[model samples]
Target: MLCATFSQIEIRGKKGRTVPVLLTSEIESNIDLLLQHREMAGIHPENLYLLPRSNFNSKEPIRSTDVLRKYGKEANLCKAENITSTKLRKHIATISQVLNLSRHDLETMAEFMGHDIDIHRSIYRLPQETIQVVKMGRLLSAFDNGTIVQYRGLDEITNYLRFKGGLLTLVL
Candidate 1:
């Protein structure tokens, strides 16, 4: 388990899954500077976890307040002088933008920053129309392959198809 102020990260096997993280107010204080800058770019702190690199230096481990303070100075944010967690969040937010972190990267950052999984998904994982198409394609493929063993009901099938944006017509 890799522990940071924002979150506790546990990396599993090659095809492993990430565990849920609990974000506390204490971790929020550490990234205050970054959050401030993110808000300026129309990105909310609640959505900060969506970015790949929320912190100024993604390569370094920001597990301590002293490290945060030192980084702030190097970034010319003077975080220690400011003393507001909000300020620190904003500063980090600004750096994140400068670094051009991607959405996938943001998810990793969210994990690193100790944001809850739900919060991370809500902000970054917007629903898309294409998802339906993909599902429909898979269903059709399964049908062709004779892999669809037992479908529950018309409504259940339709609902499943609807995910792929498909409309069902009961021929029976």
Candidate 2:
């Protein structure tokens, strides 16, 4: 999109839900530069669509297929695989698993992702293999350090360590 403002965005998400999104500082700067260039190029501000149709009289948005071809060729990615917006979505989801966000942060992310908390937990959470490997490594480290506690269910540990308001105070 050529002229999208990056401060904040309100998008119609999956199932027509209105989702609010805020941009990072880097993205905001980039969008500001792009908008300034567009103004210098004499592109009229009356057109509201970020990716406007080429025809002056047309109000429709630019076709996605046209954008795909241009983007692929410019990035030299057309030969590797079919690159689409869907790939970008999955890429973000995959990398997000590594972030150590609180429960409230996870819920906010789920809303931005256009899904309920349950769907986010079941689908976007780290893969079982990754989780097991990381946890196993931590357990081994604790054992080696002689700090390992007796094996008990996660519920018992969480209940014992959780703050009075049910917030998890343990990190790791």
Candidate 3:
């Protein structure tokens, strides 16, 4: 993360892109609490980082691993050791399937994750069950909304969704 204002996060991204993403209300509230805590603790308000390194002399943001480990321990959450930056990114990529995002949306997500879409699709390969659920969920959603009439037959739909743990070109 690069910087922050009251409303948004400015990412000095890994891919050399600087993007300002607005925070959700819930996350914004958490940030407010953090700001308040920082203020009470005499953290200078002028510091640029949203999650600053504890060392006052350092300009670097707090490490992702440090944040994960600290929160995991404080929350008494099991397997916090398993929570990592890569795992968090993969979780975002995987859980986003339930949203049935369009190609453009997926591209945006990949970019946000500091990669190209091809890498996202290939490297973030989800489990077979997750893939199956997403594909079937799409089919069911289409059918429920009467878009299934666009297809000539069930075979076509089945073939369209036959994602053998690889790219399945979406059709409607």
Q: Identify the leading candidate in terms of TM-score.
A: 3
How many clashing pairs per prediction, in order? 28, 0, 0
Where model 1 places Cα greater than 4 Å from the true spot, the runs are 1-114, 150-158, 161-172
| Candidate 1 lDDT for residue 119 | 60
**Order of candidate numbers by lDDT, starting with the best:** 3, 2, 1
True lDDT of residue 110, candidate 1: 58
Scored against the true structure, residue 130 in model 1 reaches a CA lDDT of: 47
Superposition error at 148 for model 3 (Å): 14
C-alpha root-mean-square deviation, each candidate: 18.0, 8.5, 8.5
**Residue 44 shift from truth in candidate 2, angstroms:** 9.4
TM-score of each: 0.25, 0.53, 0.57
Question: Per-residue lDDT of 10-122 in model 1, one digit per residue for the tens?
Answer: 53322354545456667666557665576564553444253323454343333445655677677787445674444554445434432335667765765554454466555
Name the best candidate (by lDDT): 3
Model 2 segments more than 4 A misplaced: 1-6, 24-47, 63-69, 78-82, 133-172
Evaluation by lDDT, superior candidate among 1 and 2: 2
List, residue by residue over 72-125, the lDDT tens digit for candidate 3. Answer: 888887787877877887889987765556889999888767767898888876
TM-score result, candidate 2: 0.53
